[model samples]
Target: MAPLMNRSFTTANTPGIVHIADSAAKRINSINAKAASNPPQAFRITVDSGGCHGYQYVMGLTKEINPAEDVVFEKDGAKVVVDKVSLDLCTGSTLEFVEELIGSSFQVVGNPKAETSCGCKISFNVN
Candidate 1:
């Protein structure tokens, strides 16, 4: 896929893996530095139902990984893991860290499967 917002991203050779942009990796490293955990943390992404746009993108930090259920993507020293079920909804998408006058957050960008996204850009609908 082409670069988005001038940010470059890399994905695993395996399919169903979401790509992480360089900007997003830098932001993830920043967040991990402030986390009050001993072993640091990794970003976790999950897609859940019930947003105004039908599916909501949820992001958080974690220190544990259930290898059988999660796929981890890494860049620099930052890592992001998406559960298997969520991967199905996010295949071929790029997760970007964006800052605007409103605020800054992780967002799912360039999702070919998404039909429409909410104003907040945290929720979306797929065909």
Candidate 2:
């Protein structure tokens, strides 16, 4: 009998991973500077189902690391971790931190999995 070949299915032409932007790096550095006194274990980037468009980007600090999660990018001691499932949807995506008159937040841009995004830029339509 012949051995079977492994087959894999992936979304768009997105890469496995990517890093944050230069501006995001600066902001992360600043955050690390302040977190120096009370540093977190890692920074987590996640996509949850719920938003104006259909999906929303969620980010926060994490002290406990999940064995199943994958570390995609890290800079200036700031690390970003995404679960296998989320990684599949965020491949070739860039994580950026934007500060505006309204507020400052972490965002996932250039997502190959995204089919469309809301006007607020807080949500997306994933394929």
Candidate 3:
């Protein structure tokens, strides 16, 4: 589980919105197009505890979803899912696909609830 979000930081977002960058949506579409699953797949983001920072982001491609616990954000026929708890902690964030010298990956950027995040970008701390 991720560290609890500071309640004070949770109210800055517009509910039911999760921004997907053009690069992220394109990447999601590419991944889903190659998926063999009958239902295709969605990129899942789950925040968990234990990192240099108070919380870390765990992401993967998933074919399963728990409706009650998951929130789906879609763009350009691509899907990104996050649990309700994580949504509360990062509602105003943008999902971005970054290409770097090391590799390319999905990252959460512009999180209004994050006080500070690690240089690696996978871990964050909320004030």
Tens-digit lDDT track of model 1 for 20-74:
8888999988877776556668889899997899999999889898877888777
Tens-digit per-residue lDDT, 18-76, candidate 3: 57888998888887776646686888888888788888889898989887778777776
Q: Could you report the Cα RMSD, in angstroms, for every candidate shown?
A: 5.0, 8.6, 7.7
Quality of model 2 by C-alpha lDDT? 0.68
TM-score of every candidate: 0.84, 0.75, 0.83
The per-model lDDT (C-alpha) reads 0.80, 0.68, 0.78
Q: Which candidate is the best by lDDT?
A: 1
Give the C-alpha miss distance for residue 53 in model 3, angstroms.
Answer: 0.9
Q: Rank the candidates by lDDT, best first.
A: 1, 3, 2
Give the TM-score comparing model 1 with the true structure, all chains together: 0.84
| Cand. 2 TM to true fold | 0.75
Worst 10 residues of 3 by lDDT: 2-11
Predict model 1's lDDT versus the native: 0.80
Give the winner by lDDT: 2 or 3.
Answer: 3
